[model samples]
Target: MTQPDLSVLDDHFSAMTWGWVGDRGTWTTDAARASLDALEQLGCSWIVLAYATLQATPQSTRIDYAAAPTLTDDEVRWGIRESRRRGWKICLKPVVNVANGTWRGFIGFFDQDVPGEPTWAEWFASYTDYIVHHARIAEEEGVELFVIGCEMVMTDGREAEWRALIERVREVYSGLVTYNCDKYQEDRLTWWDAVDVISASGYYPTGEWPRQLDRIEPVVRRHGKPFLFIEAGCPSRDTSPQRPNDWTLEGAPSGQAQADYLDEMFTACAARDWVGGFALWDWPAALYNPADAAANTDYCMYAKPGEAIVRDYYASRRSG
Candidate 1:
């Protein structure tokens, strides 16, 4: 999991994230480019360009990354090229998803081999190919940081496979590498030494920020590696701050609710030096109309008051 030092990625990664831009040709469009430009103006020092590649089920051994649902490799490269050109570090994170409408965290197999049943060995082989494919692109495009996997909870216990996958990635990507474990998993993983940095989804509920950081900080210190939240944000929905990880929660859209969450999040995190900055959940490939910001309930911060909260927080990090 070790690789060449990429000092360029050492700064507080004030990353504004764009995740799961699933459409095939979306990144090549002017709208996508304008979106990236807008993200840069938020005082962001890093950009997280994430996409999802699909498999048929959680137990499916085959990962079909080149399927029509994912962005083309050329689109990924353009994103990396455009982000670096703007003087922003790019974290190219490609995630695995289940096409059967299940969460990726549930992807798993039997602990012991069962004849005719899918095996972890089979899954890791395909998954490794999927990651190595993107790792090569990250290397070619000079991406500052690359996330090898995201929120694969059931697979976290397979330490050896993860180490091997990260080792393969290290051979291709010369820059920093990290694996994005699910929220609350910072202390659960035993293989932090397998990657250059430690990262996880930071989706703790409201009022629990300090407690969770207290829990996660020791893990980072114990491993002696840098840490960051590869994914974190609240939806405009009123219920979001209480369960920032639940996008499906029902509530009226309120930008102030989102801003309040970010305010508390940044204030709490600001006190902890080891808690590196975030890559917010998303800013869409095709932005919504600005006037409709209050009505939009999903996590995209475009034109929302929360965007201002992020801008001010990131700006303070630069000037302070």
Candidate 2:
């Protein structure tokens, strides 16, 4: 395999997560190529190839793909190769989700051993295997960055276990590494010094960008590590800006609302010199009807007004 060049890391990253599942062909198809082309036109300098693992609960000591569809290992390698071939840097983010529909943020274990209840040691043992498997792949594929986990809020308190997991990851992967902490949890991480960068989900309300940035600044300053939003976006629905993190919020479709939210987020972060960049929440593995874009109320920016806002902002950064 040809090693991907990491020189692009010095630039501000305008990225999108190509969230996909099912099979190897999904990434190698013509639609995938077209999606990558669209992303390039949107001025994306980086692409996050996100995959998922499954566990029955936070305490379950097994991480496997039997419960849900996931991209095959071969498909992920092809994705990295294809994205780099298009001149985009790559961040391999292997996330975990519970099989019972619980959010990963709720994954947790008792601090002390409890009989009949799974132990933190057991859970971390399985999680380590899940993460290290991808880390080795990231290293072999020359992925420019590796994100160990995403929004595992309850487990963040177990700093020792996470740090140990990071140590294990470093043994196999040689690249910048970071964890995607949930929004508002950034300052709580005392172990930021262990990773190459500090990252969090940037799903702040449209009106609260400045205040949230104020709260986050001290953490970034104290750690002296570069910071960026690993996941952030609002749905194209009425009132979505006020509750940008809630994907299930109900309302009529409102493209302008989503566009305005993106504009506000980009403007605020652009003013903060310490903020590095962002990888928008997602773009889909399969696109929907272009004609129905107005009726679509998801976070996807495809053929929507928010897409142009993101493109213009990212293009300006590249040009400036």
Candidate 3:
């Protein structure tokens, strides 16, 4: 397959991270359309159609993607079409998360499979099914990018499995494929060569962007592949700048803090041209009232100072 290039980023390389494993068939609602309308106003060029399925536990092998909590296949297709209709570039990101209150990064089995116990083989089979299912939809809809997986830290070490999964997806979905590694784990992925693009979650502290980028730079340069911060953004709280990855951090809602963190992020990434683009952490399918943005403290950029920060940054990068 011929690889796609970073020219896709052109000037403004940004996406409004939308969809979070939306409720069963809730994707095409009027509220969802309204949210997309608002996102359109932000000037982001891409829409990350991020959705997820759940495994019963960190050790569970079955990926129950058809469960009631997830969007049905119809909804997922509608979402892809809706975003395409809005003239946004699409990056279909299908994620697997663990239930049972455990972080998905802990989802793993022993290095060696034991009888009657779950094995990496079992998990990869299910995970590959979940990803390829969406990858086919991406191909049919002309999605420009396809992310095979997201932040599954425990599975990142299985380079051969990941490479095989990419091959499986390629057999059905012909598009640029990338994987989202957990923060600070860029160099850990020895199989970056298996995918067309390299991406990681960029949740380093406001002050740590320079150092983290320095660490990630050589990895991309060595592989000669485009890199993106496929998942990046800070929450609306003062404590977040120091640890943006901690979504549950306690602090008063401070949109300025989120704005400052992203402003610094945009500035730092500007110096690293290889830092091809970003898909900010998220926007909700059901948007909150803009009037309440100051008090609301999640990752949504609506009506917050970060919204303008993004708008300005995206606007600045465009060719008139």
Candidate 4:
């Protein structure tokens, strides 16, 4: 794939990064607000707020999306308004398969279509309606970007349906629309043309840093459009591995190693004339953030020593 010229997103990438706030739809209003403030201090220029889930629980399923407290239009509006007030962009991403970890927390869908399960059509229909509602909320809140789904690998074969759903989203969301695919699901890249930008979650292992982007850059450039790292995170100081996939926050090197890896990746991306902006997977450590609270020392660096390196690197960028 040829690399798309991304000079367009240069300003956005100057000091930009992807901020992970965990499932906001699962948090209290006060918590979400506080988290946003903390993220701002960490230099988060954009946020991908998760809004849905996989299980049929009261917390994840919203009967009246407009009024649902955790993710109602009011809450979304609050986030966007605050972001704009602080000069930031909000990318509202309502996902599925959150609780049951379906498709690695991308398309939070249950096996709702099989026997003794909710039908896929029923779940998809509801999710589509939910996405429409989110679009309306984005309009009201001035949210610039909205993501329909993230990481639905098993169900990617249903490309036709996904395309139609994106078209419908276009009818409501005047701003950019995109979906979040996992690292390897390049097959579905073409289906995202309806979106203003093509996006992927780049959580390839820490060791895969610069090389990870190198591998993806060629393909992304071929798409000839702006790209976004919809999701990303680095490990903390003391996290162990549960299992090793392509990427993980567990049992990696030290915070310095993580920082060096990110610096190399960001520098490489910045040097690229074709690549657009990139959002780091997360924010610097803070007291209240889940990664800080649970002490999951692997991925998701909130207040690790690696932060000093990141802060200094950007500071240098600002100086030069």
Ranking 1 against 4 by lDDT, winner: 1
Q: What is candidate 2's CA lDDT for residue 212?
A: 96
lDDT of 4 at 166: 79
Per-candidate TM-scores read: 0.97, 0.94, 0.97, 0.74
Candidate 4: worst 10 consecutive residues by lDDT?
237-246
How far is 112's C-alpha from truth in model 4 (Å)?
15
CA lDDT of every candidate: 0.88, 0.85, 0.88, 0.56
Q: Per-residue lDDT of 226-301 in model 1, one digit per residue for the tens?
A: 8899899999999999999998999989999999999999999999998777888888888888899889998988
Residue lDDT tens for model 2, 1-320:
23323445665788998854334357767778777777776889899888786788666777775334556788778889988899888999988888798898988877789999888888889889889988999999988889998999998889899999999998898888899999999999878988888999999998899999999999999988788898999999988999999999999999999999999999999989888889997887667778999999999888999999998988887887
lDDT of 4 at 77: 62
Can you tell me which runs of candidate 1 are displaced by over 4 Å? 1-3
lDDT of 3 by residue, 1-320 (tens): 45555466565668878978677766889999998888999998999988878889998999988787878888988999899899899898888777787888899899987999999999999999988888888888888899998888989999889999999999988778899999989988899998888999999997998999999999999999888999999999988999999988999999999999999999999998888889998998989998999999898889999999999998877753
In model 1, the Cα lDDT at residue 246 comes to 95
Off by over 4 Å in 4: 1-10, 14-33, 57-70, 101-119, 207-211, 237-254, 283-286, 289-298, 312-320
Superposed by TM-score, candidate 2 places the C-alpha of residue 30 at a distance from the truth, in angstroms, of 3.6
* Range of the 10 consecutive residues with the lowest summed lDDT in candidate 1: 1-10
Q: Which has the higher TM-score value, candidate number 2 or candidate number 3?
A: 3
